[model samples]
Target: MLLIHQLPPKPDYFRVKIWRRLQTIGAIAIKNSVYVLPFNDEAMEDFQWLRREITAGGGEATVCRASFVDGMSDRQMEAFRPLADHGAASERLPGTGKAPMNKRGRTWITRPDVHVDRIASAWLIRRFIDPKARFAFGEPKAGMVRFDRFDGDYTYEGDRCTFETLLKRFGLDKDSGLRAIGEMVHDLDCKDGKFERHETPGFERMIAGVVKRNPKDDARIARGAELLDTLYESFPAAQQRSRSH
Candidate 1:
């Protein structure tokens, strides 16, 4: 969960300034008058700076930890490294929230519209055609898991456009644990599907969730996808973790 706080009344100009600064450090605005922010040193620092800005304008200020989404977990914090590791994901910083961090960046690869395809293709290409991830297309298999599973009805469909079908033909529906993992994946994957203008930076948070909540596994995809043949039978623990947060 991310931490957030309400802002005190300030000039519109000052409020916008604070809003942009918080956003630069990965804060989301849930209410127009109140901005949702991550609970962390950076966000706290941003809030302090915000306090100064508002006070300078002779306006009131308040910074409180949001119960619903004040901040992410410690594990999620580590996921930022790999995300920033990507050149494109790095460019989003220090600016307005309209574009991806970088133009040549690979942020769009994680889009919900592309989620199903990306997982299936990455699994197939890496394990079968391009083992060792030689023909790289996605993030390295270090802090992430990849597979198509059931999450509501949308994520259950598996790879929609893949030439290698892993759904009805594969009978993944019979799997019991598949659904749970799917729900988390669906919620996390489509982070961009219903994305609002204010939630553009949310991709980083979703990816952070995926990596943090996923159970660490070895040799899942690149090793001929054999790991998924057995391990993919179970859903990840993301839902439970998310709910607790």
Candidate 2:
């Protein structure tokens, strides 16, 4: 399903707000001002909200339930959501591909701008979800699994951040050391005052440095992964103790 909107120009604020809203629902921008999402009840509701907002913002919008024939472009055909954990059923449209993938070789998608939660989530994917996972940015495509992009299968849900959701959903929550890192990510990303770890300030500075140095998403992720690996190894005794069975 696609909720396409043609917004008025000049103000820019309207476009920004609409783009953010579409991002929240994991809508891929197939073309300028045209976004795509899987047809579902939740997706429909999200589009309804967006439609209302767009209309109220002096822009015109419409939601359409769509299906594609064969020979669609890869980007046009890509799935809009992340795949479920192993053994879980994956819903797919005809000609989209097989459902419920058993392994994690799929390309892990996210926004290009890396941050605390996004970087941490990417590290988690390589370290725990899929070691050989490939990565891309900006709207998930068919056959690719996305995280940290609006309603992604592995992204934020309810009160949980993407990192926390990945940890819990993939059964990685048992690792106290990872959970410790997750607390930092949650506090930094959400600013919700949920965790009070003292290492946050220094860690955030380190992340900022990495992001500043590595301008490209692929490069930043590689650098970020190294830092996360080191941090996991150097967790304090309390966190290490939590790792014990």
The most accurate candidate by lDDT is 2
Residue-level lDDT of model 1, residues 1-245, one tens digit each, is: 23334444645765565554454445454456565444654455445545544554566667776464455544554444223211111011111122221222121122222232344444544433334443223343442222221111111122222212222333343434443333333333332232243332353354444434443322222332333334343334334434567
Across 48-73, the per-residue lDDT of candidate 2 in tens digits comes to 65676577667898989877775454
Candidate 1 Cα errors over 4 Å, as ranges: 1-12, 69-245
Model 2: colliding residue pairs: 78-141, 78-142, 79-141, 79-142
lDDT (CA) per prediction: 0.36, 0.70
Model 2 regions more than 4 Å off: 1-101, 236-245
User: What local lDDT score does residue 230 receive in model 1, on the 0 to 100 scale?
Assistant: 40
TM-score of 1: 0.26
